[model samples]
Target: MSEIKDIAKFHIFSSAYFASAVNKNQYVTDGRKEIAFIGRSNVGKSSLINSLCGRRKLAYVSREPGKTRTINYYAIQSRRTVDEVEQRQDWYLVDLPGYGFAKTSQENKDNWSAFIDEYMRKSPGLTMIGLLVDLRHPGLPIDKKAYDWLKTVAPDLLIIGTKGDKLSRNELHKNLAQLKKLFPTNHAPIAYSSLT
Candidate 1:
């Protein structure tokens, strides 16, 4: 765990909250590259953002799903040293509102779906879409639908299996195999555990 933390701490020179938007006009459009994280309401999107940013509290995480109602953006930069000079790649990590929350009214659901669709279609800086799913239960019908739609909008799509540590090694292996069959990816989905 410490090793993972150490790597995250050292690799990212800067990772900070940048923007949050409920409307299209509010989105950040500074021409920075963006990699959006998306999934169901309970798929651990916030946790993965925190882990990836090396800050435990970077993104508000809740046991209850659907707490994030807005599209949140985090600006991040990774530094590297080459030939005694420094190089940095600046990017934004966009955390989209999770879908499949049944508590919301149909109107709210429709609005969110429309908003998300608009963002994906219009964001010129969006480079890739990272879709997360629970390793314990991969390829639910909802997830499959999301992936299918994402593939059309995103030139590059990455599928990650979260909560990997919750599964036994054998179970993880089996689930990963299942994930391979469910998604159209050249590689198998990588199982991720925030704690690891």
Candidate 2:
């Protein structure tokens, strides 16, 4: 696959906080394709999003895990040239609540789980799901469960391995190989780091 080196060259404009939804009823349904980002707490989901949008603080970076409790929606508008014609595309980048390692009550975790499950199962505009995992330690039990769930519910699922900067080049490659072996799907995890 070909990669676009300069994101700005594509004339893409991204709004960090277009909307937020705490429940299924509040999800934006204006017919825009939605890409949801999900992962364990403190796996750098928010940081990865900010980096992707080419912004320093587009998504809130909290020191503590589970700081994001709602489904945050970011609108990205892009203008592309195809066949000598200019075309515009708008989509929503969704940040789902992270799971695990939150110093919250069991009740709150259960509620978040329900909310995430509902959104994943019922959202009509959800086109893709990015499942983030830490490269230092990938394929934990929770990550495996999340991958299995997405495989059943969503057709387009991408595994993202975050915190690549923390590992050496050799370690990164080894861990990536391990991750690929564990997931064992056509969708291989992409190595990513906010620092890079």
Candidate 3:
């Protein structure tokens, strides 16, 4: 237990808060840095964020596609410096709902589109957008649409691939190659496993 505690001491701490709407006038007032996690529905964006934070239940995870219907804001505070107290840190994690769920109504889809557009365009503290993809099928049309749109709008972004444990070595190689061909210059797709 002591070893576990020692290990956790070095990590960045994160706590999430759910928000149904993006009303700048009445949201959190923390001036911390922010990063966004976004992808198509059922692409394991929640799972990926959970894995990165080393917390199984921190971010909501659901088997049903598009379960996250709202923009969840997380206040991520780094480990306190050498002699600091329990409070005061700088950073945040922003988890936007996954887009492109097929079964949803057109109205819902339109709402999500507009919400994402507004969030990406209007947020000032947002630093980077972590664009997630499923490793089994890296470059779908919807993924391309997101990539292109973010490129034109939020250029500071990172592309990551999830659900890699399902793929064999050869398939992973091939899929990565295809992704490289599809997105040659800007970003490289990283294989990630949330289950691990």
Candidate 4:
């Protein structure tokens, strides 16, 4: 769907911070599915997370960009229905450090790149990668690069256009269409407004 998921159809019943990993050894080893979020710095990764969990302060919302350095994991038990049966599915929501344009030293950025790459390449629990792009800036080279790389790694993907509320409905459609040209998918990207 090119809109936010229906709160009723796919909703988080319980979500709590599970672990923060700076390396593979520290990662949660339980066999639980993981869904990850990645995007540019100050792109609202934490805010979107809090919004998805329906909790205002679940994740720290920082004014400074790239405040998240480690891979933080949250345990989630969500409600869903497969066929005719309604069931609870447990998984991990992984928040990766944001890439591109943040107030950090070049050495630190390089370290982060290596660290994030290791997790993305090694995490067996990764079920899907959710790529968030700014709805207004559809042509950012960094975002397109991330999209291309992520699709090669994870077949299951969700592309989201953030800050939908900033644009008019007509403008949102126009922007989403442009984003399609760069990040192609079977379905149009979701215009996501965490505020809504």
Instruction: Give the TM-scores of the predictions, in the order they appear.
Output: 0.91, 0.90, 0.82, 0.89
lDDT of 1 at 37: 89
Model 1 reaches what TM-score against the true structure? 0.91
Q: How do the residues 1-196 of candidate 4 rate in per-residue lDDT, one tens digit apiece?
A: 3222333366688999988999889877689888889999878889899998988888888988888889999888888887988987788899999999656789998998888877878888876677889887878999988888877775467788998888889989999988888888655677788998
What are the Cα lDDT values of the candidates?
A: 0.85, 0.83, 0.73, 0.82
Number of the top-ranking candidate, with lDDT as the measure: 1
**Alpha-carbon shift of residue 14 in model 2 (angstroms):** 2.9
**Candidate 3: where is the Cα deviation over 4 Å?**
1-10, 18-29, 80-89
Which residue pairs in model 3 clash with each other? Answer: none
Runs in model 2 deviating more than 4 A are 1-11
**For residues 56-153, could you state the per-residue lDDT of candidate 3 as single tens digits?**
88887888999987778766556645556554455667788888888889998998888778878877667677788888888799998888888867
Which pairs clash in model 4? none
The backbone clash count of each candidate, in order, is: 0, 0, 0, 0
Q: What's the CA error at residue 114 for candidate 4, in Å?
A: 1.2
Ranking by TM-score: 1, 2, 4, 3
lDDT score for candidate 2 against the true structure: 0.83
For every candidate structure, what is the RMSD over all alpha carbons to the true structure, in angstroms? 4.5, 3.1, 5.9, 3.0
